[model samples]
Target: MALLTPEDLEDLLNKLRQSNETIKASTGKGITEICEEVYGTRPASQKVAIVPITAGNGIIGNFSSSLLAITEYFGLEGYITDHPDITGYHQAVSDGADILLMADDHMFIAHNLKNGKIAANHICTGVIYSEIASRFIHAGSKDVMVIGLGRVGYAGAEHLVKKGFNVYAYDPNTEFMEKAIEELGVNAYDSADHKKFSMVFEATPNANTISEGMITDRCLISTPGIPCALPAELAENGDIDLVMEPLVIGAAAMLYSVF
Candidate 1:
């Protein structure tokens, strides 16, 4: 995907804010009240402690700021801490945060916390596959290739399957490929066969994961991966439609789930 212009980002934020407002109006409650009704007794307070952990090198601050904007738009307090270690999570919990939030490479922190390695109630906000699936649905594509079977890619494939799309998944890791095939019932394909797809979901975190020759002419590439899976020259000049955005789309999804 292409980088969203400032105007596009602003418009998206406004739309999300409006959606939240509509939910509040229909439910006759605020975020905390809605959370209590749906998710049992979460902390009623509206504060999130953000612990940044390797949220992409230069774009960390930008990602954090976008998350803060989402929180503030929902009338929640966002406390962002600088430290990206165990200490930061502890500090966030100590700072009266209702939920500890992490993004990007720090996503593993949530799994660690769940496994009892970290003593904190946390949420990792980046399940962007649903967003990609929504885009694909809008584009009227029912068959697509998922180019990675990592956490995010697998989640995306699952979402596509739920939406009644034909999902063909690929990964160099056989174990991941097997899980996708067995659990999600996705078709397994070799990476060398990527060119066969007219619609592709590229979710590997490596640059140039989707090479020029691997992309079909007029393919629709939906990529939420970091460092970009498609090359810049191909995305700019080739016969393909590339969709991309900041990682905040996943953050918004997480926030909605929390509330």
Candidate 2:
């Protein structure tokens, strides 16, 4: 996953609201509703604790607070700890938090104490975004295209294949592409292929990979990549409906997965 900067998260609550509306307009469901449908999760009646860890690069500005806001938006009770690291974890357990959320530079995770279930951000992100993309393109679409078969990308590719879509996948790394092909029964997509699909899942960290020529006017793109593959102008122009929010979707997915 691409590391997020503090600037990328400014006014994140408002951005998430707009993103939820964007998703609802396309799929006829909000983020929480989609998460529930994808994960078989319902309204969480558990107390959630967002703990800020001062390890690695230390706390990201507003990460814990943003999680608290997201939890509340999902109609769950949540709060940030008064301290950081282990102390915060102890406080969460002592304060009777049923779910614990924490992150280091390497991974973000959600843990449900009652069920001993854990959800990692990367896997949940892929599954959630792929489901959103699948739902976005309603009918007359049988093939799905996936770019960047990395950790996150591979998970989405696997899910799409299991859903009975002819998943065409590509990555610069031949090993990753081969693994997805052999393991998940996905079709290999090469750069020479000019054909486009009704749904495209962009998970590459690089930008400008999904050019305008590759997408039709009715395409629906679901991307979790930090530097999105599509241009900003096209995402807003009223042509294709694009779903590209950064961390919020993944965080919500993790929460619901463990919920």
Candidate 3:
């Protein structure tokens, strides 16, 4: 996963609105709707606290505030901790926050105090994106390809396999690809085969992983990888419907999953 800078998420509310509209265009569902469907939970009438952790690289600019905005956007009552680190956690608990959202350099997570449910950003992100891809390919299409087998990509491939899609995965790491094949019952993705897919999930931190030849006439890409893997030329085509966002949808997923 790429470390997000404040610049990467500038004017985030408008960005989220655009992403929601794009999703509606492709699948007749918005971000909130898709998350509700995937997690079987709604954000309504929930109280959340954004606790910023100053571990490792310390606090990121606009990170905690962005999380607070996302919570409120989804109809959850949200608050930010006055302090950072462990003191902030206790403050959240003392103030009757049902859900606690926090992140360090290594992990971003949401925890439901009452339910004891923990949601990791990487896993929920993959699952939600995979679910979106599944909705766009209902024409007996099962050849779903997942590009990148890191933490997020692996979680997505597993979810796709569970949903009865014949998952084909590609990662630069041979060990990661082999582990996915052995554990999740997935096949290796062959880019050279010129296999065109109706649904593709891309989660690489790198850019331009999908070239022009990799797409069919009508293809749907659900990507959460920063600096999206699709180039501008391929994305401009009318036949391609893309669903990509930097952080809002993933953070929303983390909250809803444990609510």
| Candidate 3 global TM-score | 0.96
Q: Looking at candidate 1, what is the lDDT of residue 101?
A: 67
Winner on TM-score between 1 and 2 is 2
TM-score of every candidate relative to the true structure? 0.60, 0.94, 0.96
Please give the ranking of all candidate structures by TM-score, highest first, separated by commas.
Answer: 3, 2, 1
Candidate 2 achieves a global lDDT of 0.84
Number of backbone-clashing residue pairs for each candidate, in the order shown: 4, 0, 0
* Model 3 misplacement above 4 A: 137-140
- The models' CA-based lDDT, in order, is 0.57, 0.84, 0.87
**Residues 1-259, model 1: lDDT tens digits:** 2232344455456554543443343334433444444334332345777776653432343545566776676567787786765677788767766656664433422222222222211121113433343343224456778888776687778767876878887899999988889999999866566446666777776788877655556666766676677887787764565555444445544554554
Query: How large is the C-alpha RMSD of every model relative to the true structure?
Result: 8.2, 1.6, 1.3
Error of 3 at 179 (Å): 0.4
